[model samples]
Target: MACSACGSDSAIVCSLSDEYRDYAPADAAVISICTHCLTVDPADATSVDTGREVEPDFSRLSDSVPTRPERAIPLVLAIDLCSSIATNRSAIESLLEEVERAGTDPLLVIDRLRADPDVEPAVDLERRRHQLEQLLY
Candidate 1:
């Protein structure tokens, strides 16, 4: 395939090794990218037979595996709380009720300077509701 960005023909068909190893049949098509301009070259690519079989390596399983260390990962969940409240209060109430039932602590972060201090909690709740609405509809 020609370089999508520069339209260069001097491209090499490279195998997506990582993708192939993680998820894909051995006989799946090999995706390639241009080496010169680093653009995806689909035309020059070809299917490769990986020749993988159900052969398990039992040598490495003799010893017990070590426990993995806890790591922090970013997680973002968008909910249409605002839209639910505006369009259907029952749905919003149901979601909140479920959250309460699950005993999950919901953390809400907001720009304090831009919000009124007296009604900061209310504002935050409203803002979150609006964000949820945007995500849903």
Candidate 2:
């Protein structure tokens, strides 16, 4: 179908991926995004064909939105956290002591990594964070 706003034939309608379902409104069952103008329109669950699963053009979507490297945020956060630990031993020791009470969980580790002040927010980073949050449950 042609996009309503941009009149682009590159309009793609697809069911939201499970990984990204949380980003969509709870009521949105299917969504259509125009590749040319980058307009997103969500539709009722009944609108999509259940048998044919079409993947949205993620590269196009990523191009239009600001994004961080998907897997690198955590690694970068970890490296930065370690750097902080190396440079500020006293502060690190205090924080470690505080967190020691909570026990060590991988999800908690990710939460700490995500909360780092240096990790700037971006569309891709939020998407990855949500995906990870869902997986942990």
Q: Best candidate, lDDT-wise?
A: 2
Q: What C-alpha lDDT values do all the predictions have?
A: 0.30, 0.41
List runs of model 1 lying over 4 Å from the truth.
Answer: 17-28, 43-137
> For candidate 1, which ten residues in a row score worst on lDDT?
69-78
Weakest lDDT window of 10 consecutive positions for candidate 2 = 71-80
Model 2 lDDT per residue over 1-137, tens place: 66555567664466654534433334255666555544445656665778775444444433322122222222222222332343534433333333333343434444543554532322234335554344334
Q: Rate residue 35 of model 2 by lDDT.
A: 52
Q: Which residue segments of model 2 deviate by more than 4 Å? A: 17-26, 44-47, 52-54, 60-137
What are the per-residue Cα lDDT tens digits for candidate 1 across 75-116? Answer: 001122232345545444444333334443222221221233
Extract clashing residue pairs from model 1.
Answer: 1-43, 1-44, 26-50, 79-132, 80-132, 80-133, 81-132, 82-129
